[model samples]
Target: MEFRFTVLASGSTGNATVVQSGDKTVLVDAGHSLKKLEELMGSQGIAGHDIDAVLITHEHSDHIKGLNALARKYELPVYANEATWAALERHATHVPPERRVVMGTGEEVRFGSMAVRSYPISHDAAEPVGYTFTEDGYKLSLATDLGYVSDLVRRSIIDSDVLVLESNHDPEMLRMGRYPWNIKRRILSDVGHLSNEAAGEALCELMTDRTRRVYLAHLSLNHNMMDLARLTVNGVLEDRGHFFRKDEHPLRDTHPYEPTPWDQIKRKAL
Candidate 1:
């Protein structure tokens, strides 16, 4: 069976993505309210009961806001590193002890038919991390909420078949926008979100012909336009002689992100 994945929602307001390989279905984050999450999943023909686990990226409310509620309702397991667990335990009191699973950076967690590994990311949080899910020979990397791409990150996602990466904002738009100076500085800081230019540069280095899909995620609603982010990344790829097909829809247009078949990607692999 083909592995399945979808970015149910992605933004500052909330973030969540579903990944399924065979019987196991997992959610990457639950930043929205339980109700909103249900609505988003429902749109993709997934019910709340379908998820077997929740993998948290960090302790930020925008990523864990719905965690407690979702866990309580589904009796699902939640995975995170020690520091992130500590922070979540402090803030999300409703998650049951049995449901909290501790996973270290680079450690693989296996459930159902999928194997997921977490990698550390530079961000202002207790212990932020991105995840890579592998099934059979195919890999999908979800690396958002990162400040900048590190060597380890680049190495981890180098040959991924699908990449859901952050294109958080456009620097020019951000610098000229009305956000306060402190907020702007925080965003531009090394420990903050990745700008579109940075994301484009990183993708140019990471992407190979094997990459079948690329989703630009966690975009800043106020500082980044979807078309602009698409254009920027496309330009970078084209400049490097790696061109994405024009028929592909941007992540924003692929509402409930679905997995492209591994066979198709394999045929295009370099």
Candidate 2:
């Protein structure tokens, strides 16, 4: 089977991703406006009606800003944990009850040829999770908007063919930035976003020969630059003996305003 992944947008401003297996296509989050989501999907030849479901990572506005609109417009099934659904019901009231599907963490759900499993992550929200999708022998894991990599998270994403991990900010830049102290403290806390150095360290333990592509995601526009994130992550990987190469464990970049080109991973038939 062939599995495809695309980061529609990844930053503190918004977050969304597309995961496709066989004929089924799932939108991981609808963080942008309905119009913006449509445009982003259109760029990849996907229509609103083409989506099979929407998966919520948490109830944060940056992750669910367009959930109600997109779900209602497409009549799409929106899967989320119980706590997240409760928070969504209070905020995203436009979504019909029939469209709300409760998915438990660590349970494998099938959407056509794709099997998706959610794992808990430490974030200051009702419930935040990172997802891993598998088809045949190929696996693609997405772990973003997380503060730290727990043992569950590490195990969930192990042996992934593609990984989308967070490298949110640089410690020095975030410390010196003009944000208020409380806001900075929250970001620096374990319940906050992951720093670039932390992401690199986690990757050292996570990346393996099976891990082909890793996209640095959920970057802070003010606290991080694309080049800087790549350089920092690569540097840490190199120092830890994980050399960067285009054909092996290459680091990829994601955009906050656009969609990444579809990355396809194929597995041989049994």
The TM-scores of all predictions, comma-separated, are: 0.92, 0.96
Local distance difference test, candidate 2: 0.89
lDDT of 1 by residue, 1-270 (tens): 658787877889888888887788889999888888888888777888899989999988878878888998988998888999888767845588999888897899997778999998999999899999887788889998888899999999888888889999899999999999999999998889998889889988887767777888888889988889888877776787775445753233222233222222232435
CA-lDDT, candidates in order: 0.82, 0.89
- Spell out the clash pairs found in candidate 1: none
Candidate 1 accuracy as lDDT? 0.82
User: Candidate 2: deviation at residue 98, Å?
Assistant: 0.6
Question: Model 1, 72: alpha-carbon shift in Å?
Answer: 0.5
Task: Provide C-alpha RMSD values for all models, in order.
Answer: 2.8, 1.8
Give the Å error, residue 35, model 1: 0.5
**Local error of candidate 1 at 51, Å?**
1.0
For model 2, where is the 10-residue window of minimal lDDT? 261-270
Best by lDDT: 2
**Clashes per candidate, residues 3 or more apart or on different chains:** 0, 0
